[model samples]
Target: MGALAGLAPIFGAIGTGISVLGTIQAGREAKAQADYQAKVQEMQADEAQAASQRDAAATYRQGRLIASQQRAAVAGAGGDLTDPSVIDIMADTDFETDLAARTDIYRGEQQARGLNDAAVNSRISGKNAQKAAFISAAGNLFSGVSNMYSRFGAQAKTTATASGSTRPLYG
Candidate 1:
């Protein structure tokens, strides 16, 4: 019984240490998961941007085909191919196609930026969780030490009383 009592504080400290280690491990896991998710989001954003660019290119190609067809028809029908109206129409078609392509590219870039922001937020959250875990571990360690001291103090008091003495058991 005396040997077991002497070992109580050691056992308590060991248990506290294990608990703290578990907490730290959980925090690390959470951070890792967040990082993985952020990477996935970034990848998705890149894919979306690429797809948008491809669509823009396709749209531009189609627009150019249509403009060429229109010009060919006008010349085939013996219309005034050099007329100001005919030239203006061709120019307008090309301008509209270019404008649409630019818009698509801009939208894709914006979406990528938004995803990057989300990734940053996730990183921040993960860091915060780690910090919180450290804080909690510190608190738990302190509490464990306090409890160990209290139990030891109680045991010393009980021993002193049983021995009909005023001095502490250790002294």
Candidate 2:
């Protein structure tokens, strides 16, 4: 009886290992996909940051150019200042256009990243679901085995009673 108690723990360990291995195997693919998605997200964020910094620099330079042009016109006009200087803000306009274009590109890139993350997460969830189903099936099989074990234990008791040997506590 004491030895059987010890053996029970060993069998439990074996069954637990089998169940966990199945789950790990199923999750491996999902893990790989998630890793890939994470890298892609990182790249997208880096690209967005670089573009934003460049846009800021370009906009600052364009502002300086427009300011310098207005100063030059003031000096060139000989203080008459009669006609309104048609300060074309195409430098600012071009900056606005470039910034808008960048924002649009970044949005599309991030959207793709979001989609990839969703797909990978869905795959991971599917793996977990499959693991759950496997566990459920294993539980059903163990239930059947437990029923057979109980029936056999009863037969063992009857035989021990007839044979005049003391029944073991558990085996």
**TM-scores of the models, in the given order?**
0.85, 0.41
For 27-126, candidate 2 gives per-residue lDDT tens digits of 5655566566656666666666566566656666766666567667766877433444333444444566567656756665665566556656756665
Encode model 1's per-residue lDDT on 36-108: one tens digit a residue.
8889889978987997899899989989898989889999999987899999999999999999998898888
Once fitted onto the true fold, the runs of candidate 1 whose alpha carbons sit more than 4 angstroms away are: 1-7, 154-171
lDDT of 1 at 111: 92
Clashing pairs in 1: none
- The RMSD of every model to the true structure, in order and in angstroms, is 5.6, 10.3
Per-model CA lDDT versus the true structure: 0.88, 0.61
Would you give me the overall lDDT of model 1? 0.88
Point to the candidate with the largest TM-score: 1
Cα TM-score of candidate 2: 0.41
